[model samples]
Target: MSERKRFYLTTAIDYPNSRPHIGTAFEKIGADVQARYRRMEGYDVFFLMGNDENTVKVARRATELGLATKAYCDEMAQQFQDVWRALDISYDYFIQTSDPRHHEGCRKFMQLVYDRGYIYAGTYRGWYCEGCESFKTETEIKEAGGVCPVHRTPPVERSEPCYYFALSRFQPALLDYYERHPDFIQPEPRRNEVISLVQSGLQDVNITRIGQDWGIRVPFDERFTIYVWFDALLNYITGIGYGWDEERFREWWPADIHFIGKDITRFHCALWPAMLLAAGLPLPRRVFAHGWVYIKNEQTGAVEKISKSLGNVVEPMEIITKFSSEAFRYYFMRECPFPGDGEFSWSRFAEVYNADLANNLGNLYSRVITLILRHFEGHLAGSRAWEPGEIYEEQDLEATVQQVQGYIENCEYQLALQRIWQYILDPANRYADRKEPWKLVKQDLEAAARVLFDLVESLRVTAILLKPFLPRTAERIYRSFNFSRDWQQVRCEDCYVYPRPVDDLRCLVRPGPDGKLAPLFPRIEIR
Candidate 1:
């Protein structure tokens, strides 16, 4: 037997200061899809996700809401869990930075680095955003009045004695790591950005901040709380039983991929790795920084960034309610490549769903199943012997199966779905144009049986390939055929073995009267 491949993946822990929006949900869904795909491919996969609760942002938001910081964070963290469940995210571990285990892990790691002489206490002056819980350089500070850009609030100039990590000490080591692993930071553009930043220079980063009572207290220094980013980044290890379960830690440590948004690329790709190197831990294998979602105005066609302050945040629950969780997931992944920005338009979503899901995919399945029951007495027909010259059907199935394998392996899910649909479309068009059932009952029963048998096999193949993306739909398709089993075991070639019949066919998407249907995708009118 071949050795089992191992994959440990994670999405950036979301800050619990505010409720999550589509952007955060997108990252989780994307990472979840990849993890599921890996598991289907027979890999030992561990996917981690969690909340970043140790920040002044949470404290300030709690203060604004007139609640204690822990209470506010706890409430917000539940919201995160709700969204994840609604989205069907399958994370192996959902960590919270406020967990006692996390605090212990953070302290231990900090102490290890401190004992290694990488951390020192010093007074540093800088522009600070209590809302962001991090210091900003002159250039990083956007507002002329010293307001935090993200919060749109003024920041105070602060000076305090805090524990600082000698990030500069690992500059050469980081450069060497990058040199050895070219794909460590992914999508080529992000890797180049990291390289440029590392080549430019490095600075010692403040790992602890004084006068912040909302975060993990620094080891041996209760006067200073560990900085938000530093404390939050440790969740990756803390969630995997680091500093507790040595065997479990050894099993999933050094994550295979760290999926993060472009906005926080610097923290994950730059600072986090330096911290890991300092602690003598293996670094994450890759950091993939994905871009944002742009919401375009319906009438003007002008695009704007998604922001809560602008009241333009598109909630995933709202979309899932309007459409479906599967549709929402399919649209997001299929609409854009992983690394590029995608525009979310109501019109575009309607077009894709109506054309792809409602009409092409759903209609095709319904038609095939309906025809099978009508023509074969509500049962699948036996496989007839192929004529001496008939090899095209077998060859075509083989080629399409190969295409499915390649498309999924490359993470081109849209292309994979299209390839499967192409097989369905070809036979569907032939069945419609030829009217095989009508022609065969009178003229040739064997010929019509052959056509229907081929169609059934094609439907089975389509459902199997679609299991990863549209699991619910795939299950419906499988149930329509009286098979209830994992999709991985079902192969197109194996469909020939079971010469069974399917009865009691139902419309996957029932069409309305007048031989017409209402628009499958209604426009999104945000209230």
Candidate 2:
């Protein structure tokens, strides 16, 4: 047997300022899809997600709640975990910046750069955005009236003694790296943005703050604490056992991909590479900066960021509970363009959920099995008995699989799903309508059986393709048709196998008299 390929992936650790909303859930869900896809392709996938707990926002939130910083972080960590669990995120490890191992890893990284003369003592006097946890240059602050543009609030001006990393030394190297590896940052637009920023010039970055007591303390200088970004960025490596387990760290070092939001691309693509270069570490292969999620407010009829402060945050759990997790996952994956901003509206969500999941896919599955019982006494003929014919020949299963795979490789998740639905599911539904399998049965049983078999084959292929995107639903469909429930054994080629009635699956209904039916996605009625 050949060796199983290894894949390492991570999402930007979230700052636990509040409970997760739909916006934050988007990143976790997107990363989860990628991890699932890699696993389906038989890779040894390690997906790391985490909470950035060293932020001043967490400290402030804790103070407001009259809780200790650690206590607050612990609570917030659980909240984040709850959201990820509810969303069915399959991350291998979830690291917290406040973890002792993470602190050790960050200190070790700092020491490595310091030993190389890439870090030095310095004083920083600048305008800081507490919300962003980064200093904003005058040019950035100007458009927002001396405030942080995203938060729409004035920054706190501070002067402090700090330790600085020699980021200025890596401008030429970073530009060259970007040129040599054009795909280092994804979505072309993000790469262009990073290139422009680097061409402007780079400056040394402050690595530690003197007055923060709630963050990781510097290894050498105990008086200062590590900056949030400096400490938080290391969690990606720390989660994989960077400080304590060299063997494990080396196994997955040089992550295959880093999935982050667009707002922070500069930090991940620019400063992160410089830090790794200083420490003589290999850089992550790719950084994909996905766009933000906007919610269309019903009252104002205007789109806005999904934020608690704006009183417009949509609770992810509420949606997950209202609709099945499959519907939740499908809507986001289908509606949102992976590389661009996506709008979320209850009306739109309901429409897409009903149209795609309930009406299209669910109806297709129900109709196929229903027709099978109506025509063939609840029995499906094996592939050997069913000769190939026209209704199925036009689907082109191989080309559809190749097209979806190519789109996935390019990180075009929306496009990948769109193509699958268009080429496979939609075509199956249309074939059912065009063939009128119910009508065919009265005139000719064999011809009708062939049509039902064609539809069943299409569904099997779709289930295999849908495994990574909608795992639970895929398993349900597979088992409903008497296929093995062992998902790991589910391969694209299996779709070609014709299945007959199995004793264990007899409890599932057929389409004729006394035949019961279950809707994959039940239609929702809006109040």
Candidate 3:
């Protein structure tokens, strides 16, 4: 077998201005799935996430909340950690930009760029928003609107002496990087956007903000601190010990993927690679920008963006409490393609939960287990000496298995799941139609055992493939069959081990009238 490649993945470090919503949660979950899948494939994986804590937005929010900036950021950061935990997000490192180690790494990176002649000093005159902490051009700002588009607050016009990075110096190099590495920014639309922006022109970007005492001090000048993007973007490198530990840094630099929201694509796709090139560091392999979720009125077809001010923001915790984290994860991925907009509605959520989880998967599991319990005294039948199956069944099952592997490898999880369910439905229909068990109870007990064994083996395969998405549900199914629940313990090609019959085996989920029904997903009435 060939050696497995190492994988490094990251989510955009969230700005800790407020608690995260479902938008941020989706990105984290997507990265988590990718990391978990890589690990399952025997690849070394590093998944990094953290808060972007150094910004005028954070500082002002801290003051408004009547606490020191550090304390305020610390408090908000905890909310992110709590949300990640509730969602069962398995990250290798949860890095906070406020950590002293990160501070040291950021400083070292800045020093490297400065030594390369990419750094200069200049005075910036533009529409500055204390809320955004960035200079915005007049054309970029809305003419009729007083507030910033992002922060939705008024801008503060100011001029200050600051350290600047000669971004124009890397224009040719950045364009070349894009030409050579077309996959660096994902989805043709977003990549074309970046290309057009780069070709239009580049400008010298201010790297430091004067009077921002809350941020890291510039190496030579106490009056200036690193700009928000320059400081925040470094979290990806610093979190992995970019400058502090040479050996550790070498292990996971140049992330395989950086999953970010569409709004911040420019910072990650355009500026980040340019900085890495200037410093002779590796550029990220790919940057995927996902679309925003919008809330729409069912009757009027009116759509509005989800946000705090609009009172439409869907909190991560609220969704987790209402539905299992697995359900939330599955719904988001299945509802839309990875790179496109997806609409969210209470009705749509209910429909997916009831149809996919409760009715299809959960209901099928209950029926199979219940039949095993009722017919064979609640214990799986003994393994019978086997014979080869009909060519059609064997071929169909092999095809489905191969499809499962393909979808997962390509990161098309929804398709993977659809394929797994196909295995379940096909077997369930075959078992019901055979009626071989009824005839075997008297004269053909061995034939009955063979039929039942095939069903149980199908369940085992389903459980193994479904673990990454619905871990808890998969575990329950494994326990119902009295089989080992650990994915590492079972090989995909291994024949299912028939558990010795136990008199007290019970169904994990009760079934309904169509079979034996249980409420895997109880109806949730949203307020």
Which candidate should be chosen as best, given TM-score against the real structure?
2
Error of 3 at 292 (Å): 1.7
Q: For residues 1-527, could you state the per-residue lDDT of candidate 3 as single tens digits?
A: 23457888899998899899887887787677677767765788889999988887888889998999999888888889999988888898988888888888888888888898888888888788776678876767776386677876778788888888888888899889899998888767889999998998888888898776788877767788888889889988888888688777877788888888888888888888888888889999899887777776666677778876767888888888878888888787677555767777777887877777776666656556655656666665444432215212555666776677666655566677777766655555456457555566566655665566555566666766666666676666666665543455543333333334323333344446676445445555455
The whole-model lDDT of each prediction reads 0.74, 0.83, 0.74
- Candidate 2 — which pairs collide? none
Per-candidate TM vs. native? Answer: 0.87, 0.94, 0.87
lDDT accuracy of residue 147 in candidate 1 = 73
- Candidate 3 residue pairs in clash (backbone atoms < 3 Å): 147-153, 510-517, 510-518, 511-516, 511-517, 512-516, 512-517
What digit string (tens of lDDT, one per residue) describes model 2 on residues 387-505? Answer: 33444453466666877877776778899899888888877888888989889888987777777766766777788888878989887777666554466776554554435442222
Clashes of each: 3, 0, 7
Candidate 1 structure quality by residue, lDDT tens digits, 9-109: 99999888777888778788778777876776678888999888887677778899999988887888788988888888888888888888999989999
